[model samples]
Target: MAERVYPKLIGARLRGQTSYRASFALQCVSSGLGQLVELGVILILFGRVTSLGGFSVTEVVLMYAIAGVGFGLADMVAGQLDELPAHIRTGTFDVVLMRPLGTLAQVMASDVHLRKIGRIVASLVALVWALAHNDIAWSPATALLVVLAPLSGAVIFSSIWVVANAVCFWLVEGQELANAVTYGSGSFTSYPATVYGPWLRRFFAFVVPGSFVAYYPGLALLGRPDPLGGPALLGWVSPLVAVATAAVAGLVWRFAVRHYRGTGS
Candidate 1:
């Protein structure tokens, strides 16, 4: 028999979630409301301070938007990483592996939370509002670069989740560590990266690659020169960090599958 993974599984999950219209609608509204509170915080912060680490209120809002959209997309589509331990403990993981489809694909597509669409829409509105306040000089090149920022943010965050979940093949405690990277990084990135000290900022940028997703691409889009004196090439390369992280994540996922030890075996 011939079988492929990912698409079928994702379709299955999407259909299952959409089946409950009332629950899904409530989820969407709740997610939107939650993001509204985040926007309110930004407004309060800006009210108190003129700028954050040289990031204008608009740039700070852009960071929030990029991080928000990325997080909402990841949670909606790939948030199943949260349930790995329970699956393993219950021996349900065996059923997933029994399928001809890839184990990671099946696990990832196990759930799709559609309410994130509301959050994503909210992020876009925030981004647009930021642009209106601090209009950047428009060029075709910069325009496309700005657009890619959020996409890169999404990929980076998803990759972090992948690595975090991969550790579950060894440790049940992997879940907590994973949250620090996924949730912590998302919360941290929502602010201006420059607000952190030099070492911390560099770690997020070059080490973890969070900087590429929000800060660097933001600079390109907002027409702000790089504070680190990064060359012009860095602007174009911001989006590529997401692709690179995703590629590395694929390798990590393969390793986790290879290292799999059957539950209670």
Candidate 2:
């Protein structure tokens, strides 16, 4: 059912945005430029430093593009949950509950923000450049991983975004922190996860598990060993991590819905 419904919802959104073609195009351009500028920062830094942690510039770019694609995908979909506060405040969410559709699906499908396609485009550009610049030994596993990494990461990011929006049920004011966690996870995962201190790395890896999506897989993919200690096997754990986080998010959402009382707006 989701497979059938999601595309139609997104298509409707695309048509709506298409009505204002110029505005949509500009947003896409700006998003691409923003990603490019970030890539420039990494390039400039690499000019002075040969590598970060144990990974070289090209390998890092691969990690960046992977995480970028993941988050861009999530932001294009679940990032719509950022508006939950407005929905609750204005009593719009009451209608959401009254509808026959699943509340989570409705919330995610509410805004098919096409502007994020720019970030995805930029990620693809960076990904192609990285592949060209770095000579990664390609094999069946690596080929499969390339598809799995971003896909698993996108699901993880969307789950985190859902959890963040679920908090709006009670803590109506602290939305920025949730937004930070969503966008910041992208930044945190884009680089070598081992570069950070043990505590910070543990927080993202065990607590949030963002590192599993790209950084660990990146190490395995690039054939570089992890500097901070852990089983290298964790690299392939993206699917498991995605399942865990998403399950937790689902439980939290269920709890939130039960506790909800109409805002009376």
Candidate 3:
């Protein structure tokens, strides 16, 4: 069963992506170049300014590593961010629904973006360099958290991705709105939330839930305190947030699939 499903998923992606090799290559280059530019901007900031909001340049590099790995893994495993609406509009969802597997599983497993592997490799290398350059007091427990952070972060981002795609069942335009939460959350979390104002930090903690993924745990990892002096326990909440987000996203996905089948879209 695993053999069958794995190849089916991989083959689907190869066939789909073969039609636009030039576009796919361009997107990979664009993503890498964009990250390089952002890194350059950070270097410029750190060249003049010492640190921003208690986060050193190295610390921010760690945060970027965490965020990049999280976002990259999510996009690689689940690249159907824009496919749900297209499936609905074209009635391709019927084919998914007809599959013996769960509709959500089928939809999610249908495509894998191989270009994201470049991003993942790049982030991993940056993370290693950042770890070597920074002042991290690694013990048994801290080491565990460092490893778990990316796993939790990946799950959290994938949950956001699932929610984004599921919104397509309601309306095509909903996908755009969902980007505010999914992609915007990633962009915001890439920087230390402490750099943001009070209301923005609270929004990340309470509303969007991106704070738990990296910013808080990153503070703990870096042996720093939150400038707002928020609860230190927020760092430990990463796994809980990941599990909860996945559960909620799973329920939302189920409902969306049901709605799609019932409404014939």
Task: Using lDDT, give the best candidate's number.
Answer: 2
By TM-score: ranked, best first: 2, 1, 3
- The lDDT values for all models are 0.79, 0.87, 0.80
lDDT of 3 by residue, 161-264 (tens): 88877887887657777777788887887888878888988887777788877888888888877787878887767988899999999999988777664345
Question: Which pairs clash inside model 3?
Answer: none
lDDT of 1: 0.79
Off by over 4 Å in 1: 1-8
Regions of candidate 3 where Cα sits further than 4 Å from its true position: 1-3, 11-30, 261-265
Regarding lDDT, does 2 or 3 come out ahead?
A: 2
- TM-score winner, 2 or 3: 2
Tens digits of lDDT, candidate 2, 1-96: 767887898789889987888999999999899988888999998999998877789999999998988988988888889999888888899998
User: If scored against the real structure, what TM-score would every candidate get?
Assistant: 0.92, 0.94, 0.88
Please identify which of the two predictions, 1 or 2, would achieve the higher lDDT against the true structure.
2
In model 2, pairs of residues that clash are: none
Worst 10 residues of 1 by lDDT: 1-10
Order the candidate numbers by lDDT, best to worst: 2, 3, 1
- Judged by whole-model lDDT over C-alpha atoms, candidate 3 comes out at 0.80
lDDT of 1 by residue, 186-225 (tens): 8778887768888888777777788777777777777778
TM-score of 3: 0.88
